[model samples]
Target: MFLKLLSYPRSLIGVIIFIFLTAASAGSLVIVNILFNNRKIEDHIVEFWTRNSCRLFGVNVVVKGLENRPEGGFLYVFNHTSFFDIFAMNGWLGSFRFGAKIELFKIPVFGAGMRRAGILPIARSRREEVFKVYQAAEARIKAGERFALAPEGTRQEVESLGPFKSGPFVFAINAKAPIVPVIVKGAAAILPKGHYIPNWGVWKRTITLEVLPAVDTTPYTIDQRPLLQEKVRQIMAPYFHGDDF
Candidate 1:
């Protein structure tokens, strides 16, 4: 159905609508941020905008195991599938900042909004910048705030996942924060990687968020980072592969 519905005209229409909606919503966020200068309210705006954006694209999210999320400071890790992954996560995930690539921070209004909202930008190409990002994440967690990361680093098509990076695990241990593994299914169907236009088809538009139990990092030492990374990956692999929806 997805392939059959891949109409260029319809995709173009969807893209235009999505972009217009995003600009309007983000503009509203900027106004709110400038007026209130409050992080909490800014976060709510982002979440609200995200959910509305999902609706604009005909993407309906089904969340499971949200009760599994821990109360204390923790890091959420998810498998990267599509650009819409952020919308699915932020719409449901708590008021947590995300570890984004520094390049994203260079964009005009979007970058400014991200900074005002406390999103951490990590320069993956530079070791020092990466270290600073981890340090910031640790401090945020210790301060009782949460953060999220896609350990796979970038978007991947469904079933084409790459190895998880070790940076997030190291930050988890350093912050002594629990790691929550979330498996997102069906986002790729709505918007595949490298495509700006969304499919906007109901047949492939249901996205699910499967939140797994938090992995306690208190028991692991810095030396055991690899072991910890592999363990979390092992826990998420089954859910990623087994789900037919």
Candidate 2:
């Protein structure tokens, strides 16, 4: 009974901290957006927020593999395991927009901030919405904006990646951009789905953001979609499931 009673205050405190951090970060983003016309400057704001989040949650991010970003436009694909994946990626990657859910655009400050920051939102259930989102992403790439997407569609608690969604590949094909596979580890254990509070422990967590060599889809025709998808899947398998790809 006592343990259960103590849970309320703990949850409340966590909620308060979340709100405070969110507001502080949002305010900083707004200021940066207004003051800096450069996209790189805006990206730094996001990186700052992510780093702050890691500190606030006591997350230790240890990146591995190639960190060099390609010189031109590319579709970045990564494994999704937790919401913290956003922070982990944003902290490492620079000058890229995100492909996110449309519902996130309705979340007051966060939604407005994301839209302003060039994040493309889509309704996962609606095919038309998906197309619209892809079009926007393609346009952004044409305009010289790099973008990141999670082909897993949603977070999978297991180490193995879920089936690759065609949406990201479609964007890559349309934009004629190389597909860069990114792998992240240890986010799920820090904060899993359906859990509001992170499991705050002293153990150090390793978060890798590997930028694999870009995959070229130029030679493959539209009819060879399956081959293209399988190739990306194979390249990502090792990092997704902790094996050597």
Candidate 3:
């Protein structure tokens, strides 16, 4: 019925509207950040925006294994899918900040807001600037603040799990924080690649967040990041159906 109601042209038009709505919400986030100058409030704003977006898009999120999340100082890892993946995670997952590529932190109001929203800028190498960011992350981790990461480094529309990056695992081990591997199913329908997760054909769909048991990072050493990364990937692979665009 939805397919009958939404033609290809309409879906394309809908995507524009979707992008506009996202932009407006993000602009509002920037305003909130500037006015409040508070990380906690900024967090609330981001969560609120993400929730409203799902509602607007007629997307439903079912979070399974939420109980597996440990209290404090956890590094959550996920399988990257759609652009909506970020929103879906924030809406269902906690208001924990995300660790993103450094280049994303350079994009105008989006970047500024992200900084106040406490999104950690993860760099490939240790330049002085990235070094300082790492220093801050270590302090925050020790202080019991939580964070999330997509180990695939970037989102792609694919049928299988991408290679997991070792950086986040290293970060987790460095902080002695537990790693919560999550399988996010059904996000690729929201936006694919080239055209967007999967042709933007889905208006209403259920996105599931299956949070697996947290892998204890305390025993992993810095040099063992690759081993730890593979271990976490193995744990999540079975549950990740990829449900891609």
Candidate 4:
């Protein structure tokens, strides 16, 4: 039934409405953030946006493993398939900051809100900026806040996962926070990159945020960095290839 709507001429109107709602919600969220110093209120605002987004697009979000991470202060590493992954993950991982590109900080209302919410930004081209992001992330973790990052760095459509970046692992090692791997499936089909219109349908998609056991970096020295990186990759294998890690 939803797919049928996508073929209708009125679908464009729906898309416009979605954009308007997004802008309005973002504005309201910024106001809320200013009124209350508590970050929890801002999280609630984002959750509301997430729910509305899914509804506007007629997408079903089935969440699993909510019991994982009963508290905060963990690094969330997830597969990057589409833009929707941001909202989907945020809906589940409440009150957590995200590590994004510095360019995103320039985007009008959304970017300003993200910056005000304490999202970490890194200049991908500069090596020094990478360490700066790491330092900022470590400080946030120490301050009792959690962070999420997509190591793939960009969106790609493939059955197999891309090579995981080493930055996330390094941050985890330095911060001594648990590495949580989250798998988001079916978002690519809903909306792919370089496409304006959503290929909407009554699609039922699954977003699994499995929290594996934390990697203990206490005993390992900096010389064992390669082994530590491999260990984190092995733990993430289950989501990528269905292999038992």
The CA lDDT of each predicted structure is 0.81, 0.76, 0.75, 0.70
Residue-level error in angstroms, candidate 2, position 151: 0.5
TM-score for candidate 4, residues paired by index: 0.86
Candidate 2 yields a Cα-based lDDT of 0.76
Residue-wise lDDT of candidate 4 within 130-229, one digit each (tens)?
8777877787786778888887777767534577777877787788777777767767776776666554443344444455555566555556667876
TM-score for each candidate, following the candidate numbering: 0.89, 0.86, 0.84, 0.86
- Residue lDDT tens for model 3, 1-245: 66735645555565577667666666777787778776677677788778876776667889999899898888888888776678889988876888777888787767776776778887756546544665669778888888888887777666358877666776788788999988888877666644442334444677888889999988889888878887887787776465221
Query: Positional deviation of 65 in candidate 4, in angstroms?
Result: 2.0
Q: Candidate 1: which stretches are off by over 4 Å?
A: 1-11, 200-204, 242-245
Give one digit per residue, the lDDT tens place, for model 2 in 113-162.
Answer: 78778788878999788887798677668667788899988878665688
Clashing pairs in 2: none
What TM-score does candidate 3 reach?
0.84
Residue 189 CA displacement from its true place in model 4, Å: 1.4
The prediction achieving the highest lDDT against the true structure is: 1
Q: How much lDDT does candidate 4 score?
A: 0.70
